[model samples]
Structures are given as C-alpha cells and as structure tokens.
Target chain A: MLERALSGSQRYWSWLIFLLVLMAIGFACYLYQFKVGLKVTGMSRDVSWGFYIAQFTYLVGVAASGVMVVLPYYFHNYKAFGRIAVLGEFLAIAAVTMCLLFIFVDLGYPKRIMNVVMHPTPNSILFWDMIVLNGYLILNILVGWNVLAAERKGVPYSKWVKTLAYISIPWAFSIHTVTAFLYAGLPGRHFWLTAIMAARFLASAFCSGPALLVLICLIVRKVSRFDPGKEQLRTLGVIITYAMIMNVFFFLLEVFTAFYSGIPGHKHSFIYLFSGLDGYGKLVPWMWTSVGFGILALILLIVPATRKKEDTLAVACAAVIISTWIDKGMGLVVGGFIPNPFEKVFEYWPTTPEILITIGVWATGFFILTILFKIAVSVKEEVAS
Target chain B: MGVSRRKFLKISGLSVLLGLGGKAAFELLAPGSIDAAMEPAPIGEGKRWAMVIDAKKCLEKQEKDGCKECIDICHRIHNVPNFGNPKEEIKWIWKETYEHTFPSRHNDYVSEDVHGKPFILLCNHCTNPPCVRVCPTKATWKRPDGVVMMDQHRCIGCRFCMAGCPYGSRSFNWGDSREAPKELNPDFPTNMEYPTRSKGVVEKCTFCAERLAKGQIPACVEACAKIKVNALHFGDLADEESEVRELLRHHYAIRRKPELGTEPNVFYLI
Candidate 1:
C-alpha cells in the first residue's frame, strides 16, 4: 500500500518535495533554538508560553475531532461516515504527532521530557495531558490501521478492533478536555479560569476537526480514485455548521460572564483581546480578524443553499479553521499570559527562528498526514480495483 | 472456560505491566507521602514560616531616595543577573508602586503617604501555592514549613509556575543567568555559598531557604536589620511569640491579592 504512494503523479511527488524542503528549513531553525535558549522565541518571564504552546493547544482539538466521525459511525451506525472514517482517524494521528512535537520544542529542558514519564506526576494536569495525548495517538493508530487493513482484505474487522474503535470515541474527547484542564485549573491566570473552557474547546474542536477533514476528503476525491461520497460530505458539513454555531455561542457565554460579573481580573483579559487595555492591544487586530472569520463562516454555513454547495462549504470550512486556529493557538494562550499577573500587558510576537521552527512542525505534520492519506486511499483503491 | 497457556501468559504479562503502572501512578499521585518523603523538614522547626514587611518605613525611605538595600542584597546573594532588558528581567525581589502591588485592596483616595508610595515585593510564598499545584513535574513544591521551593535542575522550564503565580514574583532565565559580569559588578556573586542559576529555568525568592537552613536570617532581612529600619521580618507564625505574628497582631496588615485565596504568607503593615 505504501509502495502505491511512491508511484504517484508528478504533482504528488512535487508536493511531497515541497513539504520536505520546508521541514528541512524548520529543522535548521530548531537547531539554532537548541543552541541558543528559548531567547530565540518571543516568550519572556511575563508571557512564558507563546507560539509553541498555542499550536499544541489548537492541534489537540484537531486530533480529538476524529471522534466526531467515529462516534456517529460506530454508535449511531451512520453508514455515510463508513467510507471516510479511516481518514479522520489518520488526521488524528498526524495532529497528535504535531501536538507532541510542539510540546517538545516548547520545553526548556527537552532532554528531561523522560522525567515526565519516569517520574509521572498524576497530581499535575500536564502529566495527565501527556498520558491522554499519547494514549489517544496510539489508540487512533491502532483502530484506524486495523479497520483499514480489514477493509482492504474484504473481511469484517476483528472484535478487538471493534472494541478499540469503541474505546477511541471517549478517548478522543479526553485528549482535548485534558488539554483544556491544563489551562482552566490554573489559579492566577484568570483568562482560562472559566468552567466553559472545556466546553468551548470541544465545540471549536469538533467543528474545526471535521472542517479540516472535509477539505482533506475534497482533496482525496480530486486526486485519487477513492471518493468519500457526497452523502458523507453533506453530513460532515452539517456537523461543522452546528459545531461552529455552538463554538461561537460558547465563546460569547465567556464574554457575557466576564463583563456581566464585573470581575476586573476576568474582564481585563477580554478587554485586552478586544479593545486595547492600558494602551497595549497588539492582539486586538488579530482577535477581530478571528471574529470576522467566525462570523463569515457562520453566514456561509448556516444558509441552506450555500451549505449544499461543495465549493462554498469548503470556503466556510476554511473560515472556521482560520478563526479557530487564531482563537485557540494565537489568542487563548497568549491572552492568558498578557496583563501578566501584575496587570501589565507584556506583548508577545514570535521571533524569526521561532516562526521558522513552527512552520517546520506544521510541515512535518502535513508530511505525516500526506503519507498516511496516501496509504489509506491507496488501500481503498486497491480494494475497489 | 477454555484458557490456553498462550492466553494465560499474555493476560498475566499485561496484568503485571498494569500492576506496575498502577503502583507507579499511585506513588506519583500520592500527594502527602511524596511531599513528606521529598523534604524531611528540619526537626523542631515550626511550620507556617511567614514574612512581614513594614511598608510605611519602606515608603518613607523610598520617597526620600530609593532604598533598595534589600533588593540589592537578595540579588547579590542569589546571583540574579541584571539583564537590563525589561523583556528579560529576572528579579527575585523588586519594587512596585502601591496600587500595582495591591489591585483591589485600595484606590487613589487613600492616605497621601501610602497612596503613591513604592513598596518592596517578592514571592508571597502562598500557603496554597498555585505554582506548586500546576507544576507538571513537581519541580516546584510547597514544603510543610510554608516555603515554596523550586528545584531548578528538575525544572523542565515549562513556565507553568510563572503563570500560576498571581503576584508576578517568578522570573524565567530567558538568557543565561550566569551571563552576569564577574568583573564589571563587584557584587555579582556576593556570597559564594549561594548557587547561580542556569538559562531556561524559572526562579524567584525562596525566602533564602539556604540561609534559613544555615541558621542565619534571609539576606534581605539581615540587610534591612543592618539599616535599623527593621522593615522586613521573618519568623514562624505557629510560634505565638514569633515577631511576624506579633507584627500582624498590632498593625492593620494586608497580603497581596488576598481575594485570590492563595493565602500569601507575606504580609505588609500598612
């Protein structure tokens, strides 16, 4: 099946080459960061976490979003998702790999990462997050591969594989929920102290994950003999639409609670993100841009006629992904840090090396995604022929 | 009903692995036992070690000419580098304006002396330290004696603790802490007994845990005592006769961000 990936057209090979080049450049930037400390990044004492952490946070959602498809298919016996379920699982595999990489790059002592495993602190949410993420990744791989393999052979999957698939449904939710807990439980960081944080994370993740899957399936349909089918796409579009609406609603709930309650500690973070608080509003523009994307996506997704069209739905999906990415990766982690516990805004802007290393990690994820998709699609094509 | 040797071995192996894992997790999760095992606190030492600051004296001295004797001594003894860049400033003890130090504690309609005066600030060493709580690697922990100790060697530099601290006391070594000038600054490592920190680790005032262990007062307290202002006080709150408790009893004192419920051990006599 992997050999089929090697025998692709000129365009596929070129795309793979392009990603490899980016990976090389990003790897070089990472080496530089390793030599010099985190000083290469935009992070300081005040804003301790920056791009690396935000990316990790966002990708966890993308990884956990695999559950949206798995849940409907396995539990509800939704036959439409059967054709493309493996791709969703593969997407999770790639996303979780990126999440792990992002955490690795962010660590001040990357070597001591083993200490997390060796001296596991279950009391720490971070320690639990590490366990769940790795577990989720392994679970997705096992279920996706076994099922895909069983399908290619034109046989029913083993009961063990079915059991693993069932376990993956809840495991997917755990990964993102634990990621949210990593932030929500913190004491001083008022921005992440809300109870709805996990809810918001799940809402956004469900939408964003399926939205990405829609785009990937569209690509798969266009490039390969494997058609993910129209029924599947329409159903996924609906999922994305509903999830995006819920995500936006969840966000506004946070806004309402913060301002209505009149807690200065809570209100200031939202103020800093939306309006300039104390003349420090670097993120104000980005936050508004995210809001614009979210609203635009809602308009496209909510309308009956527009949601029916694949091209328009693709555009809506792109909007959701962009908005959620900015909201989660850029705004959430950085906003939580700003108005540093002293109530003074310490702005963060990722440096050149930092940006390059981030790009490298994304490229690496895509590289894994490309290979996995190629294998899955190839296997499907093999069975079809 | 029919258990083959192969199945039996596989199940037993998995169970053994699971048992070991469960034990390991239980050990790590066991909060009290791990805390007790790690730092066998000095015998006969009363718990709840607290600090009290005489802010009125600090304000008067600072209002005349910035009296940073405590800050200077702590930096020297701890070897906290002067990075000069606010973006990368690594401070254990520093000065803050009265209002910034205490957000909801008061307003502009306060007394003229206390209103806009500078106040010395450091780690509150919270009794319920969120920094200790969120530490992914138990690299930082709250001792029974109330000092929140950070193991720099063990710290993965996640900066979770920095974010956890509400008082903005913690600092990360963005650049190498040992990069400070040995020749240019005569007092860089004023005390050879104190260990210099490396890059990429978070650090803050330990209430001079090493000095306390040596049966000497914290460098800042000793420095303040020498100046005769007696603004800084450190003692066990459990001891009824302790000076810190005595100061708190007489004066209208307050801790930073008290509403946050971190139960900051550091108190100020306003």
Candidate 2:
C-alpha cells in the first residue's frame, strides 16, 4: 500500500514544483522576521495584536470546524461524510499548524514560548489555550495517521483511535471557546466582555471552516480523481449555509447590543471599526467591503438555486472565506484595540515587513498543506487499489 | 436490518475514533490538581500594611509629584527601571488620571468641582480582587494580611489581570527593563523578593510585600510619613483597631468604586 501511494505521487510533479518555489519565497520572508523584532509588524502600543493574532484567531476557528464533520459522522452516524472524514482531519492538521505559526510570529520572542510551559501559569486562560491547542493538534495527527494506516494495511480497527475521535469532538470546541475566553475575560474591553463570545466564535468558525473545506474538496475533485460525490457536497453546503446564517446573526447581535445600549465603552469600538473614529477612517472601507462580501456570500449560499451550481457555490465560499477572514480575523483584534482605554484613538496599518512575514507564514501553511494533502491522496489511491 | 461489512467498518471505525477524541478532550479539560506545596502559612504577628491618602492635603500643582516621591523611592529601592518610554514603562506604582486612575462615574459631572485634585493611586490590595478572579495563573494574589502581591516567576504575561483591572493599574513589560539605570545605582538593593520581570510579563504595585516581611512599612508610606504632609497612611485593614480601619470610621475615608465589589483596602480622605 505504501509503495502504491508513493507511485501515485509521481503524477503531480508540476504542482510539487510550484509549491516549492512559493515555500522558498515564504522562508525568505520568515528569515527577515527573525532578524528584526515584532516592531516591523503593524502592531503599536495601543494595538498590541495585529495581523498575526487576527490570522491566529481565524485559523483556530478553521481548525475547530473539523469537528463539525467528526461529531455528525461519529455520534449521529452520517455516512455521507465517510469518504471525506480523513480530509477534515488532514485539513485540521494544516489549520492548526497555521494557527501555531501565527501565534509564534505574534509573540515578542518566539523562543520564550517554552517559558509558558517551564514556568506554567495554571490559572491563565492562555496557559489552558496552549495546552488545548497542542493537545488537539497531536490528537488529530495521531488519529488521522492511524486511521489512514489501518486502511492502507487492510488491517482491523485500532481500539485507541476510536476512543481518540470521541475526545477530539469536544476538544475541537474547547480550542475555539478558550480562544474566545482570551478576549471575553478582558476587563476594560467592553466589546469582548459578553458571555456570547464563545458561541459567536464557534458559529463563525463553523461557517467559514466548512465553506473552505467544501471549496477545497471541489478543487481536489477538479484537479484529480478524488470526487467526494455531489450528494456529499450538497450535505456540507447545507451545514455551511446554516452556520453562515448563525455567524451573520451573531455579528448583527453585536451591532444591536452596541447601538442599543448606547454605552460609550461598547459603542466606541464598533464606531471606530465600521465608521470613522476621531477623524481616522482607515478601517471604514475595509469594514464595508467585509459587510458587502458577507451579504453576497450569504445570499449565494442560502439560496438553493445559486448554491446548487458548483461554480457559483465555489465563488460564494471564496467570498465568505475572505469576508470572515476580514470580519473575524483582521477587524476583530484591531477593532477591540481602537479608542484606547483613555478614549484616545490609535491607528494601525500593516508595515511591509508585517505583510511580508504574514505572506510567508501563510505560504508556509499552504506549503505544508500541499505536501500533506498529496500524501493523503496518494494513500487513499493505494487503499482503493 | 442487514449491514454491509463496508458500512459496518465505517460506522464502527468512526464510533471508536469519536470515543478516543472525547477521552483525550476530557484529559485536557480537567483542571490541574491544586498545588499543595505552596500553601500560605498562617499570618504572623506583624504590622498589617495599608495606606491612607489625604486628598485635601495633597498639593494642587504637585499632585502627582507627592505621589511620585513615594513611587520613585520604592521603585528605585526595589530596582525597578525608570523606562522613560511609555511603551516600556514598568511602573510598580505611579500616578493616573482622574478618569482612568481614580474613575468616578459621578465625577463625569463633578470633575470640574475637584479640579487640580488628583488622588494618590496604588494597588487597592483589595480584600477581594477581580484581578485575582480572572487570573489563569495564581501569580497575582492577595496575601493573608490583605496585601495584593505578585509572583513574577509564575506569571505567564498573559495580562488577563491587567485587562480585569478597572483601575488601569497594571502595566506590561514590553521590552527588557533591566537595561536601564546605565550605572547600577547603589541605593537600590536587588533581592529575589520578586523575580526580575522579563519582557511580556505584567507588573503593578506590590504594596511592598518585602518591606512588610521585614517589619517595615511600604517605601511609599515611609516617604509620605517622612515628608510630614500627613497625606499617606498605612495599617492593617484586617485589624479592627488598626489606624487604617480607625481612620476609615472616624474620617469618612472612601475607597474608589466600592460598587465594583472588589473591597479595596486602599482608602482616600476626601
């Protein structure tokens, strides 16, 4: 089986070459990040966390969304997801890998991350977050690899792998919920103080995550013989639609709470991000673009007529992915920081180094995903043979 | 009712995987067993430290300066860097604005009536603190005698306490603070009473835990006492007969935001 999978790898030479070149460029950017401090990023004293943190927040959602498939298939016995359960697991591996990269880049000294473990703060949500993220990543990798190995060997099921899948279901939810707690538990940041933050994060994660997976599956099918079937796509599409609806609902709830409460503490962040705050209208256009794309994506996905067509669905998924990336990722962290504690407005724009490093980290994740997906596809072909 | 081997294989395989994942999650989610090693000893017979700020006696133009003497003395004695940059300031104690530092919701309409009068601010050393509540690490904790103290070594620099602080009292060490003071000033003695803060750790006023340990009042309190302005006072809030408690009853001393339910030990005579 291993030999057969290796033989299948030979066909994708051009794709492999392209990935290598991109990786080379990404590595070059990363080299610059190491030489200079995080000062090169768009981050400032007021806006301590910027693009890296935003990306981390988004990717954690993506990683956690894998459980949507895991839970339904294992607990409720949804068989339509059978062919692609491994895909979700593999995708989680990639997503989690990216999440860690974003966090590492966000850290002042990536080297000091180990201090978090050696001198652990058991009471800190961040400490718990680290434990959960690392645990989830390992659990997914082990289970995914073991299951794939079982199929390849034509061997009977492993007892441990089954037990591990059950753990990963709630573990997935924990990763993102804990991520939300990192914000919600903050004192002065009124926008993030609500208990609904965890729910909102999960909703957005579910929406964008499945949408991204569906798009990837379609692309894989187009470029290869790995068609997951129209029915499977349709089923996942329904999940995406509902999740996106909830995500949109969660965002609207935030706006309603902010405007209705009329509290300066809460309303200020929203005004700063969406409209102009203190004559600085930088995020206004980006925010509006996100809203426009969000509505467009929701319309395309929710309506069966539009969602039924593969091309249209792909476009909708891509649009939602970009919008969610902006709304939840970029806008969320930066917005939280605006109209600083003193009610002074501080603006943040990503510097060239910040953009380059971000591009590099993103490319690195893609590079890993490319290699990982290639291996998975190769293994699946061997099993089918 | 017949199930194909292929279908059975998928169903059972998924069930097994699900169970394993749940078990793994349960392990990670389970809270760590409480560390019994670091249990606090019973409070000994020592001066229970507290502070009194005579708001009226504080100089109008030199409001922060009066507070600064205490802050500078304590920080220098304790080897804290005067990191000049706002970004890198590691103030164990400092002055704050009427809005941020003192923050009277009533003061919104009343700040003009009390112009040029800014109260001396420090860690409330709250009997019950919100900072301690949200702390994921037990780094910032209230001592038995009501002094809020920090274990710098244990802090992960997550700054949750900083965020939880309504007073905006906490400051994060954004850069290396140890690089300051060009020449090692001889007046300050460095001991491991608190760990040297590394970059990314959050720090705030300790209420001088080491001074209290050595039967001395906090450096700020001593400085205020020496200046003879009768503005700063310190005593054990826990003791009913303590000066701080007696002053609270006799003089209409008020704590900032008693409504927040933190029960701050620090009090100001308005």
Candidate 3:
C-alpha cells in the first residue's frame, strides 16, 4: 500500500521535494542549536518554553482528533465515518510524528532524552505523556495499516486490529490530557493552574483536529479519485461546531474565574495576555485576532446554510484551525510564563532560526501526512475501481 | 520444597515492600529512629541551609556604588559565564529591585525607598520546593534536611524546573559554561574545583552545596560579611540555636511570595 505513495504525479513529487528542502534547512539549524545549545532559540530563563513546546502541545490535540472519527465508526457503527476512519488514523500518525520531533528539538540535550526512560519518575507528568504519545503513535500505525490492508484484500479487519482501534479511542484522549497536565499541575503558573485546563485542552483539540482534517479532505477530493463523501464532511463540520463552541465556553469560564475572584495572581495573567501588563503589549494583537477568528468560526459553522455550503465549510474549517493554533500554540504557553512568578512581563517571540526549525518540524509532519494520505486515498481508489 | 523462580522473585519483591512498610510504620510510631533520616547529607540538608538578607545594609551598599561584589564572587566561583544577552545570561546570586523581586508584595503606597533599591536575590531552597518535585529525571531534589539541591550531570535540560520555579531563580546553560574564562579571563582556572556545567543543563544557586559540604558558608554571605556590612547571613533554620532563627525571632523578616506557600528558606529583613 505504501508503495503507491512513490508513484505520485509530478505535482505531488514537487511538493515533497519542496518540503524536503525546508526540512533540510530546519535540520541544519537544529544542528547549530545542538552545537551552540538552545541559545540559538528565543528562549530565556523567564520564558523557558517558547515555540517548540507550544507546538508539541497543539499537535498532541491534533493527534487525538482521530478519535472523533474512530468513535463514531466503531461505537455508533456509522457507515460514512467508516469510509474515512483510515484518513483520521493516518493524520494521527503524522501529527504524533511531528509532536515527537517538536519535543526532541525543544530538549536542551536531545541526546539525553533516553534518560527519561532510564530513570522513570512516575511523579513527572512528562513521563506519562511520553508513554501515552508513543503508545498512541504505535496504535494508530498498526490499526490504520492493518485495516487498510484488509480493505484492499476485501476482507474484514482482524480481531486484534479491532481491539487496537478500541484502545486507540481512549488512548487518544489520554495523550492530550497528559499534555494538559504537564502545564496544569505546575504551581505558581496561575494562567495554567485552572481546574478546567484539561477540559479546555480536549475541546480545542477536538475542534482543531477535525477542522484540519476536513480541510485536507476537501483537498483530497479535488486531487484524487476517491471522495471522503459529502455526509462525512458535513458530520465533521457538526463535530467542529459543537467542539469550538465548548472551547470558547471553556475559555470564557477561565476569564470569569480570573476576573470574579479578583485575586491579582489569577487576574494579572489574563491582563498581561489580553491587554498588556506593565507596558508589554506584544501578545495583545495576536490574542485579539485569535478571539476574532473563534467568533467567525462559530458564525460560519453554527448557521446550517453556511456550514452545508462546501466553500463556506472550508472557510470555517480554516478559521477554526488558525484560531485554535494561535490560542494554543502562542497564547497559552507564552501567557502562562508572562507576569513571571514575580508578576513581571518578560516578553518572548520566536527568533528566525527558531521559526525555521519550527517550519522544518511542521513540514516534516505534512510531508509524512502527504505520503500517508496519498497511500490511503490510493488504496481507497483501488478498492472502488 | 524447592520453589519456582517466578514465585521466589515475587516473594522477594513482597519482602522488600514489607521491609519499607515496616520502616514507615516504625517512623510513625517512634520519634528516635526517625531522627536518622533527618541527618544532613554531604551535599546539604534541606532546612539546614538558609540565607537572611538585611535589606537596609544591602540598600546602603547599593547607595554607595552598586554592590556587584557579591555577584562577581558568586558567578566567578560557580564559573557562570556572561553571555551578554539577557535571554541567555546565567546567574547564581544577583541583585534585583525589591519591586521586581517581591512583585506580589509590592504596593503603590509603599515607601519609594523600600521597593526602589536593588535587593540581594538567590534561590530560596524552599521547604517544599516545586522545582525538586517537577524534575522528570530526579535531577533536582529537596535534601531531607531542607536544601534544594541539583545534580547538574543528571539534568536532561527539559526546563520543567524552570517553569515550576516561582522565583525565576534557575538558569539554563544556553552556551558553554566555560566560555567567559576562555575568552575574557584566560588566566582564571574556570573555578576548577567546582565542576562547570555543559550547555543545555539547568543550574542554580545550589545554596552553595559544594561549600556547605566543606563546612563553609555560601560565597555571597562570606563576601558580604568580609566587607563588614553583615547584609547576608547563612545559617541553619532547623536549629533553634542557629543565627538565622535568632534573626527571624528579632526581625520582621519576609520571604518572597510567602502566599504561594513554598515556605522559602531565604528571608529578607527590612
């Protein structure tokens, strides 16, 4: 099945080549960071986690989105989702791959990553995160490939593969929850200290992950012989709509708790992010833009007419992805660090080299995604023919 | 009868667990035997190490010409290099304004002088240190006696401790720790006795763990006292007869962000 990926058209090959070039540049910068240490990045004692960890956090959610398709197909036995279950599983593989690369790049000593394995501290949420993420990745790969193989041969997927599919449903939820715990459990980081952190994380992840998947499905419809089906796309839009609403609602709860409590500790971080505190307004515009996009996503998605229209649905999906990306990828991590424990704002923005390395990781994820999707679509096309 | 190897292994594991359980039960029942666990380790004991910074004396020194003498001595001893960029600079003991150091406590009506001047700052070595609790590798841990100690060699440089710390005290070695010596102070031996850290490891005050092992005080405390101002006082907070306790008894000392309940060992007397 994977061999089918090697036989793509000229446009596909060129896209792969372009992504490979970006990866080369990113890999080169990572080497420089490896030699020079993390100094090449725009991180500081104040802002210890800048771009890399945030990307890791967001991708964990993206990896978990595969569950949305898996649940409906396996549990509810929805036929439409069954057609696209392989697509969701493949997306999980690519996202988890990138999630891993982001974490590797963020480590001050990438070589010592195995130390976590050697000295397994169960007290550290990061340890559990590593376990769940690896487990999720392996589960998806096995289930997605075996199921596709079974489909190609015109037979039922084996019992073991079905077992894995069920395990992956819950495992997907665990990965993002553990990632949320990584920040939520930290003391004195008031912004991340909310009880709703895990809930917020899951909600955003569900919406953003499926939104990105829908965008890809639209593209696949144009480029390949197989269509994921209109019903599948429409169902995904509904999932994204409800999830985005919950995500926004959860964010508002955070806002209410901070402001109503009037505890300067809790309120100051919100102030620092939305407005600026003590004259640091760097994240203000970005945060507002995220809010605006979130509102737009809700408007375009909630209205049945706009959502039913294919073009409008794509636009809404794009809005959801962009909005959630900025909120989770930029606002959440940086906002947590702002007004440092001392309640002073030390701003952080990714340096060019940092951004390039980030691009490299994203390209690497997409390159993997492109190949995996190509294989899945090719398999589907073969089955239909 | 000969037992199977698997059963034997299970029995052995259960024996170990029971042994630990017995010790815990005994500690709960008796006071004398529990005393052994409280003994100071060579690195430093947890509550055994603390610093009391006299803000008045520090302010006077700052008024004179900026007392970076303690900073220089500590950084030089620890081989902490100056990377020039704030984003990458490393510090062990340094000066920060009272307002910045105690922002939670800072208020608008407070005397301009109190929050205006630079105050001595370093790791609090909290009784329940968050950094120690958060390290994925146990690279940092709270000593039984009370000091928060770090094993730089074991640090995987994930910066989890940095995010966990409320004080912003930990510093990451973003570049070679020995660069300053190689570039500017070629004659200096890069503090050969103290192991200089490699890039990508998080390093901090360690409450001068190396000096404590040798029965000496922190470098900044010694340097401040040598100048005869007595601004920095390092002593055991666990001992009732200790000078730090006496200082606490006599002065209205405050710990940074006391509301966070970290129970910081470092106290400041205004």
Candidate 4:
C-alpha cells in the first residue's frame, strides 16, 4: 500500500518537496531556539506560554473531531459515512502527529521529555494528556490502516479492528477533554476556569474538524476517480452547521456569565480580548475577525441551497476553520496569561523564529497527511475499478 | 512442540504482571519502609517554616531611603540573573506595590501612605501548592515543612507549574543566567557556594533551605536585621513561641489570594 504513495504525478512530488523545504527552514529555526533557549521566542516570565501551546490546543480539537464521522458510521450504522470514515481516521492521525510535534518544539528541554514517562505524576493533567494523545494516535493508525486494507481486499475488517474502532470513539473525546483539563483545572487563570471549557472545546472541534474533512473530501473528488459520495459530504455539512451553532452559543454563554456576574476577574480577560483592557488590545481585531468569519460561516452553512453547492460549501468550510483556529489557537491560551498574576497586562506575540518553527510543524503534518491520503485514495480507486 | 506459542505468551505475560503486582502489594502493606527508602531525610523535627513581613516598617524605611538591601542580597547569593529586561527578568524575591500585591482588597479611597507602598514579595510557599499539584515530573514539590521546593535538574521546562502558581512566584530561565550582561552583574554567581541555574528551568525562593540547614536564617531576614530595619522574620510556624507565630498572634496579617485555598505561609502585617 505504501508503494502506491511512492509513485505519484509530478504535482504530488513537487508538493512533498515544497513541504520538505519548509520543514528544513523550521528545523533550522528550532535548532537556533534550542541553542539560545526560549529567549528566541516571544514568551516572557509574564506570559510563559505562547504560539506553540495555542497550536497544540487547537490541533487537539481537530484530532478529537474524527469521532464525528467515526461514531455516526460505526455506532449509529449510518451508511453514508462509510465511504469517508477512513478519511476521518487518517486526518486524525495527521492532526495528532502535529499536536505532538508542536509540544516537542515548545519544550525547553526536549531531551528530557521522557521524564514525563520516567517519573509520571498522576496529579498532573499533562501526564494524563501524554497518555491519551499517544493512545489516540496509535488507535487511529491501527484502525484506519486495517480498515482500508480490508476494503482494498474486498473483505470485512476483522473483529479486533472493529473493537478498536469502538474504543476509539470514546478515546477521541478523552483527548480533547484532557487537553481542556490542562487549562480549566488551573487556579487563578480566571479566563480558563470555566466549567464549560470542555464542552466549548468539543463543540468547536466538531465543527472545525469536519469542516476541514469536507474541504479535503472535495479536493479528493476533484483529483481522483473515486468520489467520496454526495450524500456523505451533505451529511457532514449538516454536522458542521449544528456544531458551529453550538460553538457560538457556548461562547456567548461565557460572555453572559462574565458580564452578568460583574466580577473583574471573570470579565477582565474577555474585555482584554474584545475591547482592550487598559489600552492593550493587540488581539481585539483578531477576535473580531474570528467573530465575523464565524457569522459568515454560520449563514453559509445554514442555508440548504448554498450548502448543497460544492463551491459555497468549500468557502463556508474554509471560514469555519479560520474562525475556530483564531478563536482557540490564538486567543484562548494568550488571553489567560494577560493581566499577569499581578493585574498588569503584558502582551505576547510570536517572534520570527517562533512563527517559522510553527510553520515547519504544520508542513510536517501535511506531508504525513499527503502520503496517508495518497495510499487510502489509491486503495479506493483500485476497489472502484 | 512442547508449548504452543499462544499459551507460552499468556503464561509469560501473567508472570510479569504478578511480579509487578507483588512488589506493589508489598509496598502498600509496608508504606513507611518504602517512603523512608525513597524520600530525602527530613530537614528538622516537626518543623513547618513560615515568614512574616512587617510592611509598615518596610515602607517607612523605603520612604526614608530607597532601600533594597534584602532584594540585593537574595539575588546575589542565589545567582539570580539581572537581565535588565522585565520580559527576561528572573528573581527569587522582589518588590510590588500594596495595591498590586492585594488586588482584591484595593480601595480607591485608601490612604496615600498605604495605597502605593512598596511591599516585599516572594514565593508564598503555599501549604497546598498548585505548582506541586501540576508538575508532571515531580520536579517542583512541597516539603513536609510547608516550603515549596524546585528541583531544576528534574524539570522538563514545560512551564505548566508557572500557570499553576497563582502568586506568579515561579520564573523560568528563558535565557542562560551566566550570559547576563557583565555591567548589570559585575561578578556573576557572587556566592560561589550556590549553584547558577542553566537555562530552561523554573526557579524560586526556597526559603534559603541550604542556609536553614546550616542553622542560619534566610538571607533576606539576615539582611533586613543587619540594616536594623527588623522588617523580615522567619521561624517555625508549628512552634507557638517562634518569632513568626508571635508576629501573627500580635498583628493583623493577610496572605495573597487566601480565598484560593493555597494557604500561603508568607504573611504581611499592614
């Protein structure tokens, strides 16, 4: 099956090469960071976490969202998703890979990473996060590869594979929930101390993850002979619509609680993110841009006529991905650190090397995604023939 | 032919599980022996360390002359770097204003004397520290004496402890301390006895645990007493007659973010 990926059109090889160049640039920057310490990044004593952590948070959601397709197809016996279920699993493998890489690049002592395993402290949410994420990745690879291989051979996947798929459904939820606990369980980070954080994370993940899947399915349809099926894509659009609505609704619930309670601690982060607290509003415009895109995505996804059109659906999916990425990946982590524990605002922005290293990780993820998708699509095309 | 492969695997796996479980059961049954074997020896018998800062006396001294004797001595002895940039600054003990130190208690109409008074600040060494709770590697932990201790060598530098600490007490070595500008710190590691930390490790005041082990008080307390300010006091909280306990008994004192249930050992007398 991997041999299929080895032989591809010029476009495929070119794309891989392009990603390789970006990865090299990023690796170089990372080496520089490792030498000079985290000083090369934009983080400070006041804002200890920055871009790498934000990306890790958002990618965890994307990885968890694979359950959206897996659960409906596997548990509910929805036949429409059968065509694209493996695609969801493969996407999860790629996303989780990126999540782990982001964490690696962010560590100050990447060499000592095994200490998390060597001296595991059960009390730490990070300890659990390490367990769940690696577990989820392995589960996805096992289930996704075995199912696709069975499909290529025109046989039912074995019983063990089925059991693993069933286990993966709940494991998907655990990854994001553990990631949320990493933030929500911390004291004094009033912005992230919300009870609804896990719920909000799930809602955004459901929308954004499937939205990315929809766009990928469309691309797969354009470039390959095997279509993922019109009915499958349509059902995913409906899932995106409901999930985006829930994501927005959950955010407004946070807003209402903060303002209604009139607690400065509760309201300060929101104000800083939305309207600038004490004349520091670097993120205000970015927050509004996310809001605008969210509204745009909701309107496009809600209209059945537009959503039925592939072009309009593609636009809406792109909007949802961007909107959720900015909201979670940019705002959530940095906002919590503002007004540092001393009630003084110290803003964070990524430096050049930081941004490059981040890009390198993303490129590495896409490179893996391309090869995995190539193999899966080749199998599908073979089965169709 | 003697044993089927599946049967052999099952038997081997069962034996491994039993071996691990037996050791765990033994440890569970004899907890004290395992604890004694693993843990470092206790620092002092039945001692719970605490600190009391007399803010009123400190503010009077600061008002008369901008004195930072305590900060200078603690930083020097600890090999704390002077980065000269707040973003990269590292400190074991530092200063903050009264209003900023106690944000929840800030009143707009407070007296001019107390409103902006400089308050000496450091690790509260919380009785139930969130940093200890969130350290994935047990790199930062609380000793039995109520002092939150950091093991820099064991830290992976994930900075989760920084987020967990509500007081903002923990500081990561974002850059190498030894590479600090020569002008700011003319003689780096002024006290050769203390270790200069490498980059990418979190550090904070240990209540001068090394000095305490040598039967001396924390450097800040000694520095303040040397100047005749007598604003810093350190003693065993568990001892009713200790100086810290006596100060708390006679004066109204407050700890930062007491509502969070961290139960910080450091208290300030206003």
Per model, kept true contacts as a fraction are 0.75, 0.23, 0.78, 0.84
Which of 1 and 4 is ahead in TM-score? 4
- Model 2, A59-88: lDDT tens digits are 999999999888887778898776677788
Instruction: Put the candidates in DockQ order, highest first.
Output: 4, 3, 1, 2
Q: Write the per-residue lDDT of candidate 1 for residues B1-270, one digit (tens) a residue.
A: 799999999999999999989768868889467556666546234578889999988777776777899998888878877867788888889987787888776665888877767888999889899888888888899877888998998888888788778888898877666665456455665668777877778888998888777667788999998988889999999989889888888899988988778999999998
Per-residue lDDT of candidate 1, residues A329-367 (tens digit): 889999998788777777999999999999999999999
The RMSD of every model to the true structure, in order and in angstroms, is 6.6, 11.1, 5.4, 5.2
Winner of 1 and 4 under DockQ: 4
Q: List, residue by residue over B34-153, the lDDT tens digit for candidate 3.
A: 666775546543346788988888898879977777888998888878776678878888878888888877788888778577888889999888887788898998877566888888
Better model by DockQ, 3 or 4?
A: 4
Q: Candidate 1: what's its TM-score on chain B? A: 0.81
For candidate 4, list the clashing residue pairs, or say none.
none
TM-score for each model: 0.92, 0.81, 0.92, 0.94
Candidate 3 has a DockQ of 0.62
At residue A252, give the lDDT of candidate 3. 94
lDDT of 3: 0.89
After superposition, which runs of candidate 4 have C-alpha atoms over 4 Å from their true positions? B1-42
User: Could you give candidate 3's per-residue lDDT for residues A253-357 as a string of tens digits?
Assistant: 998888898988888878988899998989999989998999999999999999999899999999999899999988999989998866667899999989999
Best by TM-score: 4
Q: Rate the local accuracy (lDDT) of all candidates.
A: 0.88, 0.75, 0.89, 0.93
